[model samples]
Target: MSWTKKVLRINLTAGTCSPEPLNMEWVEQFLGQRGLATKYLTEEVPPTTDALSPENTMYMITGPLTGTMASTAGRYSVVTKSPLTGAVACSNSGGFFGNEMKCAGWDMVILEGKSPSPVYISINDDKAEILPADEIWGKSVWEADEWLHTKHQDPQLRVAAIGVSGEKGVLYSAIMNDLHRAAGRSGVGTVMGSKNVKAVVIRGSKGVDVQDPKAFFDATNAGKKILAENPVTGEGLPALGTQVLMNVINEMGAMPTNNWKDSVFEGASKISGEAMLEPRDSDGKANLTRNGACFACTIACQRVSTIDPEHFSVQNRDDLHPSYHANSGGLEYEAAWALGSDTGVDDIDALTYAQFVCNEQGLDPISLGSTIAAAMEMYEEGFITKEDTDGIELNFGNAEAMIKCTELVALGEGFGAELGQGSSRFCAKHGHPELSMTVRGQEFPAYDPRGIQGMGLGFATSNRGACHLRGYTVASEVLGIPIKTDPLETEGKAGLQIAFQNATAAFDSAGICIFTSFAWSLEDVAPQLNAACEGEWTPERLGEIGERIWNLERLYNDAAGQGASADKLPPRLTEEAVKTGPAAGKVNGLATMLPEYYAERGWSPEGDVTADTKARLGL
Candidate 1:
């Protein structure tokens, strides 16, 4: 069967691990991964419950296709209430871990209640245990991972672990797996830390089987062929990875620079994908070692890169980890924009070092770097002094200052403790809330909404704060994946955003990479699922499931006080205009779009799901 048909429930308070039957009914409705996990969360955890309390429940779930022969089927999601945003948090990650979980005969691992002391979960097929983590309790993710492998004497053990920043309660801490891949948003790791979970180590030998082996083989082969022929998936992504977006986004005037004070960065080309390929002066080698891939991923878009040894950031730093000396997960577009352009730093090596620190210490670089940008703005505006930043001059373009901030925040020490609260709270505390550049207390991503209008609407209503991954209208507006649309126009974008959002939800639920959508639509995805699982999965059915999942998450956030009133952007985006580039003299017209979006979603004017709509979805 495609379904493992088993759920592992780990109660830390009782120090017990029990197997529960998979709810087939919920699986049919929600599909898997994000949707199914959220359903379990809604049933077990209350939205009003304190996110850091023992009451909160965390679910690590995989999709039906995970660990199978399907391409890019290695995705997993961590679902829980976010301590950072006070809303639903579902951070997706890709690595060997999801495949391991599925192979270990589990579809989901649900953690309930808090442990009295630091502990790690060790899973070996059907056997599971919670063991003391006193030795690795205060270690970084990399350090803990090393310790686990050494102690277990199993180099293949897949580990998802938090770092010292997480243990210290950094609001944007992430869970790093396979050394570099991360569930890197909405403070999922902070919640893990609060529950005293230091790490999850798993190894599996039982392989996944689909409903029909011959049909599954045909379906997967066809899917992989589509990826191979598509330019975005086959050539562009594999050649330069997500770093390809740095220059393209900057050229489009959608790159948010200096905390959204401007929409263009002069250093865009200097820190772009092309730059990563240029030979370094010291060793005559490029930063990128090669392209890598997740389990069964044919695209091979994951970047493996290293910092230049002679670069100022790491040249004399004995504090740097040995892995930094070698190759690791490199700067993607989001990390580059946040740490490089948004903060006014052009040094690629410095950005690389900062990204390494993020993976090493389990911090969300997007939130961390964006928070630093806000601090830089506040420092320049005389809102904060050097004394406030522990005597570090935090002016924009100060690479040393940015690196210092990264190191401090990695440990959650000194002034880093304040920065760990995230940009929205940090800016508000410094008497400059308007400069935060956020929606729902989460920092905005690479694309500036002023240039790409639909993103503003997507960011405003995202269930998990100001995240771009939730809807990603950029495919249509900027890349024109399926069809070309005017980036500046507000007309018809309401329907466009809804289409992308619902479709994305389906892709995320199906245990696949959303990047596949660059070429494949739901029409392409339906056949794969239908062949693998025992179901009649059509594009229309998947679309309905996606809509239902969106409404369900919306209801949860509504009850958590992040209701329709919270669906909005910072005044800077709505009130101030873009100062330069193609979108100069323009501000985001979110007000003109939200009403239309609500109507398209069959929701009330206030953005609440109507009773009739709920009944239609059978919610």
Candidate 2:
């Protein structure tokens, strides 16, 4: 009964939007959101298909718990082939959009073929239309969002849109929703732009219903209690947001400073969560104004922040968006690390300004900042000249240079186009492939593989490229959610990584935030699903489903030729030793862990899903 059993198929080339029945059989096997959408992608698009081509299909999907009272249930995923990695991409986001989509009675929206001109999909309950978007096509996400709302005069409308970065073919463009929240990794927005789809606006009046109302209430309320009691999900996240990790990771010697040449940053504390709360000298205001929540989210980890108006980045800037002048989406840990630490900038206001620009213009800050870091390395090495950077001095620790690169990339102009292709391509072009700290063409987040041993293996074997969300060993290795593990020791990390990977797949598929995993396990999740969904949902069954999903994504990547060979860390991580603190003189033990990981998963030594494993999962 939780299943809407509806699909919206939009063919941009033919200018057709048709309704189709959801495959009930697939739904039973794969569940919903990431898992269900992947099943559609595998059937429709071939492994060899060009990610930016019309042949590569895109799925905008909601899970079974979506539009429900489940905590963090507003999450949705943009599933497609990534233009940056040429691998399957599923980028999740939270805001009001997913709930609206489900309320409109659609479980998924599939896009195929390219439009002759720029267009947007607007849905109001059963009514849906494709409208010309010429006026807003090249605008920033903020500009486009405002234009759409004013044009339609629907104050309640929820919009997910791209910006000039997406429209201009920036490979790492994001799909921004709620003006700030994003499906922010792996270039999902690039694929959207390739199809000439600029935005999707939705408004739904039909409310969501579950199978067992009384049991659903009991299950959900119990889950909320667990979150409230847990320290990480309750106090830590709510008080500091994700920026809390800035000082913690730095102290651990895993901060990945100056493009990962060092393990620690000298200026970590100045850009930390605690610092965000400290009153600034100018107007005595803190960078963080307040905490916020997505639909039904009680944790309220979302940060609302204002840049120091007197800071050089924003001072006297006449072209700044109104959001920059006031509180907006603040810097998360990854964005702060990439823009500040990795580039050696360390100016808090500059990082905040860059983050706002990223949201406004639909760019992935991880890729954007990491790419510029690589460019800075090249400039310092004299591999490239100031002429190549369009007269801007591309130097590490120069906040002005960092800000300039950000603005240029948002517009996809001049030197920005080169940087927009991501660090892998940029480094390769400059004959320094070793300089790009990436796995499968996607930039790694803040954690250094050398310090956090399991994370290295996690990044290497991650199906979606160097992503923490896919499987966060950090919970155990660092925060010790379920149990504490040695962050330096590689003894049991293979098993640790596998467990996290499988469990995370379940969490992601169930339409809940992985942050909830800090307190709630699948055992906690099973009661809610068993009541809300039609079938029996034991922890055992959910575990198997998570494992099945992991294998499915792995098999798809293998078929796409990003096989076992692509499962590797960069040379700099494997060859060079970290220079400071607890992890001094250490390198990642991925080689020692890879074989054990393969054996635990019951895959072949070559890292392909075995016939026996496939039969066991009934794949």
Q: Write the per-residue lDDT of candidate 2 for residues 1-619, one digit (tens) a residue.
A: 6668899999999999999999978877778888888888888999889999999999999888988998888888899989999888999999989988999988888889999999999998888899999999989999999999999999999999999999999999999999999999999999999999999999988888899999999999999999999898889999999999999899999999888999999999999999999999999999999999998898999999999989998889888888898999998999999999999998999999999999999999999999999899999999899999999898889999999999999999999998999999999998999899899999999999899999999999998899898889988888876899999999999999999999888888887787889899999999988877788778888888889888888888888887698989998888899989999999999999999999999999988899999999977
Candidate 2 to truth, TM: 0.99
Q: Give me the runs in candidate 2 sitting further than 4 Å from their true place.
A: none
RMSD of each: 0.8, 0.8
lDDT of 1 by residue, 1-619 (tens): 6789899999999999999999989988999999999999888888999999999999999998888888999999999999999989999999899999999999999999999999999999999999999999989999999999999999889999999999999999999999999999999999999999999999999989888888888988999999999999999999999999998899989899888898999999999999999998899999898999998899988889999998887787787678888898898888988998989999999999999999999999999999999999999999999889999999999999999999999999999999999999999987889898778888888999999999999999999999899889898899887888999999998999999889988998998988888878898888889887888899999999999899999999999998698999999999999999999988999999999999999999989999999999989
| Poorest lDDT segment (10 consecutive residues) of candidate 2 | 24-33
Error of 1 at 439 (Å): 1.2
Candidate 2: lDDT over CA atoms?
Answer: 0.92
Q: How far is candidate 2 from the true structure (C-alpha RMSD, Å)?
A: 0.8
The clash tally of candidate 1 reads 0
* CA lDDT of every candidate: 0.92, 0.92
